[model samples]
Target: MRPFRATVFAAVVLAAVSVSVPVAAAAPGSGSSLPGAGPAVHPDNAALDCPDLLVVAVSGATDSTADRNPIEEETRQLWSNWVGNITVPVGEAKSRYPGSVGWMYVPYPATYGLGLFQDVPTYQDSVAAGVASTNRILDEQKTRCGDRTRFALVGYSVGGEVVERVARELGHRPADAHVGPDDVAGVVLIGDPYRPAGVDSLGAPGPSGGGFMSSEPADYGDLTDRIQHACRPYDIACDAPEEIAVLELALGVLGQMRFTLANPLQTIADAERVVSTMAARAAAHIVSGDDWWQSDESLLDVLRVVADKTRPVPDANLGPDRLREILDWAVGPGLPVVQEKLRAEGAGFVEDNSGVVELVLKPYIFLAFIQHIAYWNNNPHDPWYWESEKIVDWIGALAQEERERDSVGN
Candidate 1:
C-alpha cells in the first residue's frame, strides 16, 4: 500500500501544491500486473468465438470517483454511434467480409483533476493498466483466432496517451509474446498528448508543436505507419508544447498565489473549477450539429460541482475588463517574442503552429464561454465530426482488408 510519488509537469501550470497524490481506494483488480497478463485470459481458445478484428477503444480522463468500466463503455458507444452505422455488426461482418469488427474495452484508472499536476500517477497507472488489458486481449484473440485476429486502437485525449504507451511497449515486447505491430491493423488517436510535429496525421495539425509528453524525441516503434492522429486546431490539450518552460516560472508563482489557497475547501473548489472549465471547453469543441454544450449533462454536472465548491478568494472583485487587462499584460509583450522564436525554429505562424497564441487564447475564448465553444461544432458546410468519422472509416477498411487477407489464406 505504498504511495507512488509523481512529479507533475510544472510547465503545464496545473501541478497540485501537495504534489503527492495517494493511490488508495482506486478501482478494484489493478496492481503490479505485467502487460497482457490481466483480464484477457482465454484458456479455451477452441470454444471462443470472436470477430475478425478487435477494436480496442480507450477514453480520456474522468472524475476521480468515476469508474473505468463506464468510461470504456462510453467510448465503445461513441464508436457505435459514429462508426457502427457505416458497417455491419460482428455477427453480420462475416458474410460481407472474412469476419466482423468487435470492441475490446481496456479498463484503466481514469482519475480526474488537473492532468499535469494531480493525475501523473493516475496517467502512469492508466498506461500500465491499458497496456496490460490490450496485450492480454490481443494474446487471447491470437490464441482464439489461431493467429488470425487483427487489432485497431482507438483513443481520445489521455486515452490516446495510453494507446501510444501500449504501442511503444509492443515495440520492446518479449519474443515469447506472440503479438506485435504486424497483428495491429490500424490506430486512431483523437487529441493524443503524444502527437508530435511529424507523425502520420489523419486530419488537421495540432496547435502546439508537439504532444504533452513528447517534449523529447520519441518514437511509436513499428506502429507509426498504421497510426493516424487527429488534433483539432484550438485543442490546447494536444497541440500545446510539451514544455512551456518560458511561462512556467510565472505560472508557478501565480498557481501558488491563486490556486493554492490557505483553506482546504477553497483549494478543492478552485481545482474543481479548473477541471470543470477544461471539460466544458473540451465538450464545447468536440460536439456537433446541435449545441450539445448548452444541454450537456456533463457540463451541467461540472457547473453543479463548481457551485457546490464556491467560495471567495483573491481577485474576487476583478471584473471581466480587469481580467482582460491582466491577460493582455501577461501575453502582450511576450507574444512577439514567442512568435519570433517559433519562426526562427522554422515553425509556421499559422493558427495550427502558433502554440503561444493558443496557450493564451484558448482560456479566454473556449474555456470562458459556453457560447464560444462552437469552433468545431458550429459549422455545417465544414463539419468537424467528419475528422473523427474518417478515422473510424479507415479502421473499418483496415479490418476489412486484414479479414480479406486472412480469408484468402484460409
Candidate 2:
C-alpha cells in the first residue's frame, strides 16, 4: 500500500470531487473574503424547486432507520418535535403551511461505526452523495413549491460535515446558482465535526478546539451570519484539535507496526479489531460528556484517571435500574468486553504506547456508555441537550420570520 501521507492529499481531493465540492484551505479568491473569488458550484441548483419555507435536516453517521434515511429521520423528528408531536396532527402541518413549510431529506452513505482507515473514502463518497441528493431535493421541492421558497439547513456529525460543504457551495453561487442569499433563512449544525474552534456555536463547545478529522480551513462565505454550530464538549469529531488527531493516527500506525512485528498473521487477523477500535474511539467523542482519561506516562495511572472520571456518572442522581437500562443499550450484544474492562481493569492496553492503548480501548468504553447516536433525547441538563434544542428553536424562529416577511410582502 502507498504511504499514508502520500494518500492523504489524493484521498481528500478525490473525496472533494466525489462530493462535487471544493476542499481547499485558502480563503476564497486568493485571500479575498469576497464571495466572488469562492470556489464554483459542483451540484447544479438551477432546477431547484423551493417553497415559502423549506427545512432540510441531515442526521449523523449511521443515523438511518430501515425505512427512513438519516435526513428523513431528522426532518421527521424536527417536525414531530415542533409540530407533529404537539396537539396538532402532522398532516395538519402541511395543511397549515399550504405548501409553505416543505422539507427534503438528503441521501448519503451514513457508514456504520469505525475503521477510519478504510472508511474515510466512503465518507467522501457519502459527502458527494449528500450534496447531490440535497440539491435534487431542493430542485424537486422548488419545482413543486415555486421559486419563492426559503431554506433552513441542519446536519449532525458527518451529516454536519456535509451541510457545511453545502453551505459553502451555496455561498459561492455558480454562474447558474438560482438560489440566492435571500433564499436561505438559516443553517443549524449539531455535533458538527467540521465546526471551527472560533466559530460561534449555540450549544456545547467543541472538545478539541478544532474541526473533526479535517486539517483544512473552512470558509462558510456569506452564510456565516445564518450558520450556527452545536458541538458538545470533548466531541473530538467537532472540537478535537487537528494535532491530537494526527498524533493519535501516528500512534495507531506505530501500534500497527508493533503488532505486525509480533505476528504478521495475528496482525492480519486483528485488522477488524484495530479498525473497529479506532472507529469506536472516534465515535465516542461525539457522545462522551468528558475526556475521562489522560496520560502522563503509566498505563495504570491513566486507568486511575478513567475510573475517577467515570465514577461520577453512576453516583449521580441516576438510579440502578436506569443505569442498567442505559448500560444495556450501550454495551448490548457485541460490546460486553468493553464494560468488563472498564469494570475490571479500569482500562485496556493494545501496545506500549498509551495513545495506542487509548485508540483501541477508549472507543469500547465511550461507545458502550455514552449516548452519542441520539441527540434528540439528550437531557436538558447535558450541554448538548440545550444545543440540540437551540437548533430546533432556531429553525422554527426562522420559519416564523419568513412567514412574517411573507405577510408583510403580501
Candidate 3:
C-alpha cells in the first residue's frame, strides 16, 4: 500500500546487527546471534540439553480430518518415528533424551494445502503474525517449563516461513528478548521458499523452462503440468505448457533477492538486532494495537488477514493416495530403527546450554535438479520414489532434533 518504504529508519539498525557468533554456519551460536536466539548456537562443547524440547508447528492445512486421511498413517508414522517409530530413517530423538525432551505438533485448521500461509494479508503482515505467535509460544512454554527448559522453533513449509519471520523480528537485541535464551534455544526452518509478499515473479516456473511449466521441474512435469493446467483459473502462476508459446513471465520479488523476507541481514549480529527491534515494536503493537506499517494495526486484523489469504487448492494431483504412500514409505517398517537413529543425534548433545541459529542457504532453488521424465514418474510404482518425500523427511529430521533435545534434559 505505502510506497515500499525504503526510507524507514530500520535500515540503520540493519547494518549494525549482522555480527557472527563462534558457532559455525551449521552450529548453534557461541555468542548471541539473533537478539532472541538465546545464549549461543553450535555450542559444540557446552553442556547441551540431553533431551531437547521441540514445538513443531504445522499450518492448518486441512479444515478437519478429511485431508489427513491420506497422511493419517504417515502422521502416525511420523509420530512413531519421533516418539517411537522404527521404520523411519531418522531415529527418535526423544528416546535418547529420557523425560527431558518431547515434541508437540500444533495442528491448526487447514485452509487447503496453503492453509494460513496464503491467509497472511501480505507476507510481511503474515511475517508479523508469525513473530507474535513465536514470542507468545515461547512465553507460554517458558511458563510451562520454568527456567529449566531450553528450546527452539521448527517450522515446515509455511511454518518455516514463520521461523524466518521470528528470526528477522528479533534482529535487534535478542538478549533483551521477552522469550529468554534459556527458554527458546534457537529456531530451525525447513522447506521454506522465502518468497516476498505479493510478488508475482516469485511463483514457480514451468517445465521446458519456458511457459507456466518453466519454473516447475521437468521430472514430475506431467503431474505438475496437470496441476498447473487445472489451476489455471485460480492461480496466476499455474499455466499450461501449451500456453508457453504465447507469453513469458518474470521472476517474483523474492527471486531478485537471495535472502529471506523473514531475515534480510546475513550475519548473526544484524539478525539479532532486527529481531529484537521487531520484538520491541511487536510488544508495543500488541499493547497499543498500533504499528500498521507491517502489522495490521490490531490483533483481530492480523487474524482476519491470515484468514483472507488462505483458499482451496483446485488441483488434486498428489492427493490422499499419493500422500499416504509417501508417508508409509518414509515412516513405515523399521519404526524402531528410525527412532533409534534420531535418538542418536540427541546422544550427540550430552549437555545443556543456550544459543541462536541461522543457516546460510545455498543459492539452489527448490526442485532444482529435476530432469525431463515421462508421465510415469507420477505413478507410485515408479522408481523415482517421489523425492519430495525425502525432502519432507528432512523436515521431520530437523524437527526431531528439537524433540530429542527436549527429551534428554528431563
Candidate 4:
C-alpha cells in the first residue's frame, strides 16, 4: 500500500476506536440559554413590544477545556470565537436600525466530543440542543411580539445545521409551530455542512460539490428562496466530492456519535443504515461492472447471501411483540455482515479511484480544518470575497428595509 492510503486507514482506525468509548453526560437544562443576549428593542412589559425585525444568531462548537468537567462547561456561557462572525453583522444592523431591530444570541453546549480524549457533548447532542434552544426562543418571541415582527436567522458551521433544520420546520408551516414561513425574512448560513451543490452564495457562486451530509436533499419548501449560504472552496464540510462518499459518510457517523455516547438504539439505527447503503451501492457497482470491483461478483454475492440470511424478518411482517427481537438481530447478527462487506470493498474502491482521491480527496481532508475556520476572514486567494462583510452588508440592508417599511406605514 502507498503512504497516503496507509495514513487514511490509520486515521479511520483511530476514529473508529475513539467513537467506541463513552463520555460523560451534560447537566440538566444545559441545552437552553438566554445569557448575554441583548435586550428587546421594546420594553418587556409593553403591550405590543415588537421590533420591526428580529435576528436570531446561533454559534458553532466552542472550545473545550480538558481540566473542567463536561457538566461545568455545559453550564457556563462560553461561546465560540466564531460567534464574532454573527455578532459583528448583528451589531452593525442594531446600530444602524436602533429600536427597529432586536438580537438574540443562542447559547448551546456547542461541544464536539472525541471519545475518551475530549470531555464534551457529542456532535449530535450539541446540534440537537442548539435546535431546541433556538426554537424555544423563537416561539417565545413570536408570541410576545405578535404578528408585526419579522425574523431573520444567522448561524455558522454546526449552528448553520441547526438554523437550516429550524427553517425547514418553519417552512413546512407545522401546526404546532409559533412562527411560520411568512414570519421569516431571511436565513444566512456560513460554512454549513448541509449546503447543497449549485446553490448561489450570498455574494458569489458556491462550490460545485455539496456538503458531507448533503446526500439527503434539503427541503426548505417556502423559505428556500429567502436563504443564503457561503462555502469556501476546498472546505470538506460543504464541498465533499462524490468520489469519497464512503469516507465522508464514515466521518459523518463518527462526528454524530462523538465520545458523548449516543442512545444505543439510535446508534444502531444509524450504523445499520450506513452499512446497508454502502453494501447496496457496492452491489450496484458489481452489476454495472464498474472499474472499481477488480474482482468477480461471486464473492460479493456470497456476502450478500450471508447478510440476507442473518437479517431479521422485514419490519412490515413484524408485530409490536417482535420489535425487541428485530432490535436484537440488528445489534447482533445482522449488522456485522454488512460491516464486513464494507470493510472488504472499501479499500479496493479507493485504490481504483486513487487519482481523484490524490488530487481532490486528500487536499480536501487535509485542508478542511483551515478552510472551515477561515470563512470569517477574507479569502487570501479570492480577495473580492469576504463572507463576514457580505453578511454584515446583507443584514444591515434587511434592517434598513424594515425601517423604510415602518416609515411608509406611519
Candidate 5:
C-alpha cells in the first residue's frame, strides 16, 4: 500500500455570546466504546486574544502496546508542527486565522498525555480525566490570561469521537459548566468512527460512522474501495503510511500516531518485516542461551512474538528536512484536487467488522497506511498536490468571521 497524508483550523475570542457562531461539535459513541464520566467546562469567555483549542487524539482501535508509541510521537510532532503551522506570517495572518488561534486540552491523569491508546473503560476514564484536565487548563489559562477565551477542537480518529463527546458536552454544558459561544471554532474530526447528527463541516467517517477504525490492516477489502473512491487523482497506495498518525490515527486506543513516534515501523509491510525479524531473533536467542539467566523458554516465544507484533506501521520522517516538507505542504496551495480526491476515496472506502478486531489486534498493522488513506483523501496537507490551499481558504474565512464579529460588538 502507498502512504497518503492529510491534515485543518480555527480561532475565536470571548464575546458577549450575542451572535451565534455556528460550528461543528463532536459527539461520543455509546455502548462499549463510550468512555466513563462527563467532562466539565465552565462558560468563561473573558479572555482577550482568542479561545484555546481542545485537541483530542484517538488510538484508532484496540488497546495495546503497538498503538501507544505512535500516539505519543504524533502528539509531540503535531504540537511542534501546529505551533509552527499556526504561527501566521504577518502577511499570511488574514489567510488562516482571520481571528486568532488559541487552543488547549486539559491534562488530567490520562486526559491529555504525550500519547494515548486504551480499552473502552480506559477510554471513558481518559475522557473523564480529560474533561477535568481541560477545565483545569482553561481555569489556569483564565487565571493567567483572563476569562472568555475563544477555543476550537481537533479530534483524530477515535480521538475524534472523544472530541465529539467533549464538543457535545461543551454545547450542552450543564447550567454549571459553561463556555463562550465561539469557544470552539470547529471540531476538525479526522477519520472519526461516528458522526453525530447536526454537525457542520464534518470530515471523513467510514461505513461505521466516520473514522479510520479498521478491525485490522490486513483486512483491507474496503481500502481499495476507499482509494478508488476517495483518492482518485493520485495513487493512494503510493502516498505513505507514515503520515497516518496525522493521516489515520487520532482515534485508536493506543493512538500510535499520538505516541510521538514511540514505536514507529514506517509501513505495515515494514512493520511485518521488522516484527518477523524480531520474532526470529528472539526465538533464536532463547533457544541458544544456555545460561538460565536468559531462560523462560516457555513464555519467551510468546513474549517475543507479542513484543515484535505491537508496533504501528507508519512512515515517520522525523528528519528536519521532512518535517519542513510537511509544513510546506500544509501552508502552500491548490487543495481542490486533494479535497476532491478525498471525497471520492472517502466515499468509496468500505467498512467490514468481520473478525476485524482479531485481525488488526488494535489495527497497528496498517495504522500507517490507513492514516495516509484517511488524510490524503481528506486532509488539506496531502503532498500529492497542492491540497493546503483549501485549508488556507478556510482559515481566511474563519478569521474574517471572527474579525467581523469582534468589530460589530465593539
Candidate 6:
C-alpha cells in the first residue's frame, strides 16, 4: 500500500487508542449519599437540599471501571487518567464548600473496541451506553435533589462525546427529559471528537479545523454559552482538517462498521450515504474538468472495496454479487473518460503542497494520538499550564456560585 493509504488505515484502526471491557448497567444514584446528608424529606415538599452543587463526570474510553458496585467516596478520589482530572477538581471544590458540593462519575462500557476480533462493545455502542447511563443519573439526581441543586458536567475523550450528546439532548428539553438547560451549571469537555469548528477553547486558541466526526458548528440551544470545550491543536478527534477527504471517509466507514451487528439497517443506510457522497463528488470532479480526478479515483477505489466487502445492500435479497456488479459497471467504464479529461486538462490538479501533506500526514496522526491522551498532564506548547487545572478552577468557581446562590435563597 502507498504511504498515505497505509497511514490512513492505521490511524483509523487505532483512532482513540481502542481497548476496554464492557461495563454493566448500574441503577442511577445507587452510590452512597453525599456527605452531610439532610434529614429525609419528600422531594415534592421543598428542596431537600444538602449539596448545593452536583458535579457529574464521565471518564474517557478505557479509563473507567466495568464493576457496577457503588463507587465509594474514597474510591472516587483515587486518581485516574481522565476521570481523575475532574475528580480532583470536584474534590477541591467540595472541600472549599464543605458539605455543599457533591459529585458522581457515571460508569459505562467506555470502550472503543472494534468488536471485529473481540466480544466487546464497539465505540458507537459504548458511547450510546454512556449517554444512557449518564442521563439516567441526571434524571435521578434532578428528582432527588430538586430544582435548587445545580449540576456541572465534565467528560474527557469518548466520555466527552457522551457528555456532549447528553447536553445536546438536555438543551433541546425533550418531553421526557428530566433535566433542562436551566438545571445545568456548566459543562466541560476535553478532547471531544464532536467538538465543533470555530468555537473557542477554554484557555488558548484552538485548531482551525473541527472534529473528525463532526466538523459542522454545534447547536446546544440555551446551554451553548454554559459549555467549555478544550481541544489541543492537531488532535484528530477534535481538529481534523476538512481537506483530508480520505481520513474523513475512512473514519465514517470504520465508525459505522463498529456498530454493524447492533444495527445492521442503520449501517447499510450509512454505508450507502458514504458511497453516494463519494460518487457525487467524483462526478462533479469529472464534469468540471478538474485535475483532482486522480484523488477522487483513489478514494473511489477505497469505497468500491468497502462496498464490495461489506455488501451493504438495502435489500438483503439483492446479494453482494449483484451490488458488486452494479458498482463495477458504474465506475469501471467511466475511468477511461475521466483519464481522457485529465489528459486534456494538462498537468491536471498538481498538489501544490503534496510534500507538505506527506511530511505532516503521519506525524499529524501520531501527534493526535499523543495529544488526545496527554491532556491530563502534558501540554505541548506550554509546560507551565495544564488543561486539568483550567477545569479545576472552572468547576471550583461554578461550585462557589452555586453555594452562594443557595445561601441567598436561604
Cα TM-score per model: 0.53, 0.50, 0.32, 0.64, 0.37, 0.64
Write model 5 residue lDDT over 1-410, tens digit each, in one string: 11223331111111112112111111222112112223321122112233332222233222112112211222321222221122222114442542244333322223222322221223334454344444444444445543334443444433444454455556544434445333444444444333322122223322221223321222212121211111111112222221222123323323221221233333343445545655554544433433422333233223323342233223343457765764565356525533454455333332212223433344435343333233422233455432223333443455455556656766
Which model scores highest in lDDT?
6
Between candidates 4 and 5, name the one with more favorable TM-score: 4
Residue-by-residue lDDT tens digits, candidate 1, 1-410:
01111123421232232223222224334442222323433221111345567777665554222233321222221112222222223223334443366664455554332232232333444445555655665666677675666778777665676677778777666656688767777777767665775444574443545554443455767776777777655455455554443332223222322222234565566556556654444333323213322332332222322321111122233457755754574488646644454444432213223345546755634432221111112123443455544664576677678667877988
Instruction: For residue 206, give model 6's deviation from the true position in Å.
Output: 1.4
- TM-score, candidate 4, is 0.64
Q: Is candidate 2 or candidate 6 better by TM-score?
A: 6
Best by TM-score: 6
Query: Residue by residue across 1-410, what tens digits does model 6's lDDT show?
Result: 00111244554564533442334433333453233323431121111233677777788766664442213332321223455545554565466446566667677766654333334554665677677778777776787777668888888888888898888878888645568888898999888877887578895678776776566678898899898998888777777664444555565455444443455565566567656755544443333333444454453333433432222322223346755754575479757755565564433223321223642755664677767755664233444567776787787788788878878888
* Candidate 6 colliding pairs, count: 0
The best-first sequence of candidates by TM-score reads: 6, 4, 1, 2, 5, 3
Q: Candidate 4 lDDT (Cα, whole model)?
A: 0.58
Give residue 35's lDDT in candidate 6 (0 to 100). 30
Instruction: After superposing candidate 1 on the true structure, give the runs of residues whose Cα lies further than 4 Å from its correct spot.
Output: 1-48, 63-98, 113-121, 174-176, 198-200, 203-208, 246-358, 361-385
Query: Which regions of candidate 5 fall more than 4 Å away from where they truly are?
Result: 1-92, 95-99, 105-124, 139-148, 174-177, 180-182, 196-368, 372-392
What are the C-alpha RMSDs, in order, of all predicted structures? 17.2, 19.7, 26.8, 10.9, 21.6, 10.4
Could you tell me the TM-score of candidate 6?
A: 0.64
User: Model 5 — TM-score against the truth?
Assistant: 0.37
Better of 2 and 5 by TM-score: 2
Clashing pairs in 4: none
Local distance difference test scores for all models: 0.47, 0.46, 0.31, 0.58, 0.33, 0.61
